[model samples]
Target chain A: MTEHPGADVVIEAQNLDLTFETNDGPVHALKDVSLTIDKGEFVSFIGPSGCGKTTFLRCIAALEQPTGGSLSVNGMTPDEARRNRAYGYVFQAAGLYPWRTIARNIKLPLEIMGYSRSEQEERVNNVLQLVDLEGFGGKYPWQLSGGMQQRASIARALAFDADILLMDEPFGALDEIVRDHLNEQLLALWARTEKTIGFVTHSIPEAVYLSTKIVVMSPRPGRITDVIDSPLPKERPLDIRDTPEFIEVAHRVREGLRAGHSE
Target chain B: MKQVLAVLTVVAVIIAFWYAASVPMNIRGVLVEAERAGEVVDPPKAADRRQIDEFELILDNPFAIDDTWEQERPRLPAPHQVAEELWDTTVEKKITSKRSLVYHAWVTLSATLLGFAFGTGLGILLAVGIVHSKVMDMSVMPWAIVSQTIPIIALAPMIIVVLYSVGVQGIIPKAVISAYLSFFPVVVGMVKGLRSPDMMQLDLLRTYGASKAQGFWKLRLPASMPYLFASLKIGIAASLVGAIVGELPTGAVAGLGARLLAGSYYGQTVQIWSALFGAAILAACLVGLLGLIERAVLKRMGMA
Candidate 1:
C-alpha cells in the first residue's frame, strides 16, 4: 500500500487540525487527522455528529481552513485546487435555487466557469441523464420530490465534471428506502465515472456498502479511530450487505465507534 | 367574482356614509338659501339655527334636505358631487383644456414615473454596493434610514428651491422630490434580498471559484426579485405623493397638486375632491401595474 505511486494520490492530509474560536471559547472541530485518498477510490468518513467527518471533508474542499498541519488536493494546496476547480461539493440539503429550473440549477456552475451556451445545454442534458432525471430538467426544484431533489442536486454537482466529488451527508435527510435506492445508484455512478469520492455519513451500513475504505472517527477534539480497507469485491450488489465480508466490516466499524465513545 | 363583490360592497358602504354625512355638513348653506327665498323656518334667525342640532333642523325642514347634496360649494362634498365633478373634468371636458383632469394627471404621472425610474436605479446600485462592501453596509444604510426620518413634506420645498436656484425647474424639481421619497424603500428591501442567499448557497459558488460579479448576477440579483417588486410598489406610491407635494409649494399650474391648490383658494370643494380622487386613482394604477409585472416576472422565473 505504501508503494503506490505519488501521481495516484488525489488527496493527502498530514496531521490536519482545525479549532474554531467562538464566543464560548475554542472548539476542536478536527485534530491530528491524516489520510490519503487515491484516484478513483470511494472513501467514506463515518462517525457520529461532531466527529470532524464533515469538517475533514470541508478542509479538503477548502471551505474550512485547518489551523495546523498540511493538506493537499491534486498535488496542490486546497485553495489552489479550489481555484482550479478540483472538486464538486454537495451539501446536506438539495439547496437548489427556487427560481431556477432543474436544468438551469445544474447549469449554474457551468455558467460561472464560462461554458459556451451550447456546451452548457449539452452538459446539463448529460448530467440529467446520468442521474436518471432526463425528462425532469424543465421542472422547478419545488416541483420535484425530496429524493428526486437530492438526485437533481447530485446531477448539479456532476455537471461540471470535476475529477473529485465530495458529498457531506447528501442522503442524511432521506428515508431508509430512498437511501438504500440512492446508495445503490451512487455505487453504480462511482463505478461508471471512476472519480475519487469523499463522502461523510454516520450510517454504518451505508459507509460499509458504498466505500472502498471506511475512516471511522471520534468526537472530543475529533480524530480518526480506524481506517478499514474493505475485502469485499469491486462489483457490489445491494444484497452484498448480507454477505459475511460486508457484515464483518460493518461490525468492525461499529466496534471502532463504540471504542471511541467508551474512551 | 367574490373579491370584486367584496370591494364593491365596501365602496357602496363608504358612499352611503358620505351621502348621510353631507346632510349635516351642508345644511347651514341650504338653510340660508331657503331663508333668502322666504321659506318657512322654525328657527327664525341664522344664529338661532346654528344652536339647534343639525339633525333636528333636518327634521323641521324636511324639504331642504334634498338641497344638501346639490350645493355648489359645501363644507364636505357629497360622494356623488365629487364623482360628477370627476366625470365632468375627465370625460366631459376636452383633454387639452385647463379644466381637464387627464392633462393634470398626465403631468403628475410623468414626474412620478421619471422619479421612480431614477429612484429604483439608484436604489439597486446602492444595494449592490452595500452588499459587496463593508464600508457601504455600515455607512450608507444608516444614512438611508436617516434620510427617511426627515418628512418629505418638510424637505420638498427646500429641494425645489435649491434646484430652482441652480436653474433646474419644472418636472426635474418635482421628480427629484419623488426620487427622494421613493429610494429608501428600495435600498432597504434590496439589501435584504441581496443578502438572502444562505451560507451553503454562497459556499457552493465559492467551490466553483465564482467571482463576486458572477455570484451577484447568478444568485443575489435573481433572489432579490420578490423583494424588489414589493419595494417598488411602495416606492411608486411614494413617488406620486412626492410629485404632488412638489407641485404644491412651487405653485405649478399643470399637475394634480396645482389643481388642489387652486380649488382650495376658490372654495371649490368639488374640484378639490375630484383632484384627490385623481391622485388616488393614479397611485392605484401605478401600484397595480407593478403587481402585474411582478407576477409575470416571478412566474417566468418559476418563483410565483
Candidate 2:
C-alpha cells in the first residue's frame, strides 16, 4: 500500500473485520476489508447483497462498530469525525420525514447542527436548487413523485455542506429513467461542491458511470475483490456508457463479482 | 348522508327492540294495577292472578297491553320513560338543583377531565422514562401492568379510604383513581409509539451526531403522534369509568354514579337507565372529540 503523491486521503481502513453474533452462528459481515478514499473522489462500492458494501459505508458514517481493525476519517476516528459533522449520509429510501415539508426536511440537519435561522434557510434554498427541487420545498414528501422525493432527500444531505457525502444506493428504488436523470444531477452537484462521495450500488453501470474508482466486493466474509480506476473523463454524458473504456471497466467489475462468487 | 342514515337506522332498530322488550317486562305490574282499578281481572282473585303467566293474562285482557309501556316503577322502564326522565332532569330542572342530571353530569365530568389530565401527563412522563431508560422498562413497566390487574372496583374503595384519612377528599381522590385507570394504556401505547422509529431513521439521526433529546423531539416525538392519539382515546374512556367508579365508593351526593345508586335504592328504573345513558353519551363525546383532534393534528403534520 502506497499513497498517491500529494493526494489528500479522507478515509482509510485497514484489516477491518465485523462479525455479527446471531443464533445461527457468527456472521462475518466484513473481513480484512481495506480501502482508502481520497478528497474530491467519487468512490463507489459495487457488489451483490451481503457483500459488505453498505456495511463499509455504514462503518465510514460511524453507524457500525468495526470489531477488529483501524478505520479513520480525515485522520480522526469515525466517531470523532461524525461528532465534527464530517459527513452526510443518504439512505436507500428517500426517508424524508413525511411530517415535514421538503424545505423543513432539508433544514433538519442544520437545525440539529445548530446553524442560525438565516443560514439554515439559505443553505436549504441552495441545496434545493442544486438538487433541482427549488420550488417544491413547501410540498410534503408524499406530495412529490418518487424521483422528486429522493432529490429532496439529497438536498437534505447537502444542506449541511459536509466535506464527505456517504450514500447507500440513494437512487436504487427509483425507475431506470428517473435513476439516470438523478445520476446526472448528482454528478453535476458533486462537481460543483467538490465533496468526496462514497456511494454504494448494486448496478455495475451505475458504478462505472458515476464513480472515479469502483471497489468490487464479494460476500461470505465480505472483502474487496478488485479496485478499478475508471479511465472515463470526469465530464460524463449518458452516451458515455457506449464507450469502449466504460464497457472495459464494467467487464472487470462483472468478472470480479463472478470470481468472488466462484471462491 | 349515508353515514347519518346508517346511524339512524341502528338507533331506530335498538329503540324498537327496547319498546318490544318493555311489553313483556312491565306486563305483570300493569296487570296488578289493572286489578286494582277493578278492570275485568282473570280469576278475579290476587292469589290466582300470581299463578298465571303475564302473557296469558295479556291474552285474556288485550286492553291491558297499552298500559304496560307507561307503568310507574316497572321492572324495565320503557325507552320513552327513560328518555322522558332524562329530559325532565336535564332540561326542566335547574342545573344547580340536586335533582338536575346536568349538575350530576358536571360533577362526574369534572373528576373525569381532571383525572384524564393527570393520567395523560403521568402516562406520557412514565412512557418517556420507560422508553429512555432500561431500568424503568424493566422495573416500572411490570408494576404498571400489575397495577391494572387489580380490579378498579376493589381498589376504588381503598383509594377513597386512604385519601379520606389524609384529609384529601372531594375530586382529588376520584381524580387519582381515574388517573390510575387511564395511565396504563398510555404507558403501553406510548412505549410502542416512542420506539416506532425504524433503524434507518434512527441511524440517519445518528449520522448527524444528534443527541438523545434532539432525536426525541425531532424524530421520536412526532413519529409517535398517531399512537399517542390512539392511546389517548382509550385513556379518556378509562378515565370516565374511573371517575364513575370512584364516585361510588365515596358515596358522592352529586354524580352520575350517585344518581345510579340513588335510583336503585328507590327502585326508579327510569332514573338509573337515564344515568347510564348519560355516562355512555359522555364517553362517546369524549372519544369522538379525541378522534377529531387526532385528525386535525395528524392532518397538520401531514400524517393523516
Candidate 3:
C-alpha cells in the first residue's frame, strides 16, 4: 500500500501554510501541510476537533484562499479551478434552500453553471435517481427527514459531475444507522462513477470505512501525523467492514487518531 | 328584591333626565305652532316641554304621514335609516348613478391600485440599489426613513398641487403620493431579505463560479421571497393611505373622499359613515388581491 507514483494526480498541495490574522493574533491553521490526491481516489481527512480538516477542504474548494504556499487542483490554482468550476462542494450542514424542493435543490448548481434547460432537467433527474430520491422530487427540504435532506445535498454535488468532490463531514449530523447506510451507498457511487473524493471527518471508523487513503491530522498548528493507506481493497462492500484486512486498517487508523489527539 | 327595584329606579331616573334635557330643544320648534293655534301658552322657555312633545309624537307615530301635523322629527336618523339611504343611493341605483357608493368606491380603488403598483416598483428598485452599493445605502436609506416621517397627510396636498402645476392631474398624482409612502417599507424589507444568505451559502455560490448577477438571480432573489411578500402587504396598505390622502387635498369630485366632504357640508352623518366604510372595504379587497398574487408566485417558485 505504498505510494503509487504512476497514479493520476488530481490535486497537489506544496508546503501549504495558512495563517489567520484575527484580533487575538496570528493563528496558524495549517503549517506546511502537503498532500497529493490521485484521480478517482477516495481520500479522507480525519483528526481531532479543531485540526483544520474543514479549513483544508475549504481552501481546496477555493472558498478560502491559502495564505502561503501553492495549492493546485486539476493543474490550476484553486482560484482558477474555482472559475473553471472544477469541483463540487458539500458542506457539513445540508445547506439546502428551504424554499426549494428536492429535485430543484439538486438542480441549483447546474442552474448557476448555466446548463441548458434540457440539460438541467436531465442532470437533476439523474442525480435524484442516483441519491434514491426519485419519488421525492416534489417534496420540500423541510418535509424530508435529515438523512434524506443530506442525500439531496449529495445529489446536488453529484449533478454537475465536477472533477473533484469536496465533502466537509457531509454526515456529521446523521444518526449511526443512516450514516452506515449512506457510507456504503457513497462507496458504491464512487466505485461506479470513478470520481475523485476528498472527505473530511472526525470519526476514525467512518474514515477507515470509506477512505482508500486516510490522512491522519493533529491539532495545534494542524499538521499531518500519519498517512494511512488502506490495503483492504478498493471495492468496499458493506460486509468488507467485517473482514480481517478492513478491521486491521480501522485499528491502525484508530491508533494514529489516538496519537494525534494526545499530542 | 330591594336592590333590583333600586337599580330599575336609577335607570328610570337617567331616562327621565335624558327626556328632560331634550324638552327645551323640542319646544323651540313645537311652541311656534301652539302660538299660531291661539292656545293659551306660556312664555317660550316655560312652554318648552320637549319631553311631553316627544312623548305625544312617539305615541301618535310622527312619521305615519297623517294630514294633521305631517312632519318627520329627525334630530339624528337611526342606524336603519342610514342603511336604507345607503342601499337606495349605492346598490339600488345603477353603477353609473352619481349618488352610487360603488362608483365612488371604484374611483378610489383605481387610484389606490395605481399608487400601489408605482410604489412597490420604486421600492423594489431602490432596495436593489441599496443592497448593491454602499454609497446609495448611506445616502438613500436615511432619506427614505426621513421622507416617511414627514407625514403623508402633510405631503399629499403638496404632491397634488405640484403635480397640478405641471399638468399632471387625474390618478397620476394620487399614485405618486401612494408610491412615495409605500416604497419605504419595500426598500427596508428587501434590503433585509436580499442580505439573508449566510457566509457559507455565499461562498457556495462563489465556489460555483457564479458572477454577482448570477448569484443574485439564483440565490439571493429566491431567498428574499418571504420577506418581499411580507413587506408588500405593508406597502399595499400604505398605498391605500396615500390614495385616500391624495383625494383629500385635490378637489376629487367623484371619489369617496369627495363624498365624505359633501356629506360633511350638509351634515349627512350617515353618508359620511357609509363612504368611510366603503373605502375600508375597498382597501381590504385590494390588499387581499395582492396577497393572492404573492401566494401564486411563491407557489410557482416552490417557496411556500
Docking class of 3: medium
If the candidates were sorted by their TM-score against the true structure, best first, what order would they fall in? 2, 1, 3
Candidate 2 on B165-272: residue-level lDDT in tens?
999999998899999999989988899999999999999999888899999999999998999999999999999999999989766587999998888889988899
**Weakest lDDT window of 10 consecutive positions for candidate 3 chain B:** B63-72
Return the interface RMSD of the candidates, in order shown, one decimal each.
0.7, 0.7, 1.6
Residue-by-residue lDDT tens digits, candidate 2, A28-130? 9999998888899999999899999999999999889999999999889999999988998999998989899999999999999999999998998899889
TM-score of 2: 0.97
List runs of model 1 lying over 4 Å from the truth.
Answer: A1-7, B1-3
DockQ for every prediction shown: 0.91, 0.88, 0.52
For each candidate in turn, the TM-score is 0.97, 0.97, 0.82
Best by TM-score: 2
lDDT of 1 by residue, A25-140 (tens): 99999999889889999999998899999999999999999999999899899999988888999999999999999999999999999899999999999988888998999999
Backbone clashes, each candidate: 0, 0, 1
Candidate 3 on A211-262: residue-level lDDT in tens?
A: 8899988888887888987887777777877888888988888888789777
Query: How well is each residue in B1-304 modelled by candidate 3, as lDDT tens digits?
Result: 9999999999788655644544433443445455565654444343454445545543443322121221124333333445576787787989898889988877877887888888888888998899899999999999999998897788788888888999999989888988897888899999999999998888877877878898788788888888999898898888877777788877658788878887777776667767876777777887788799999998887666
Name the runs in model 2 displaced over 4 angstroms: none
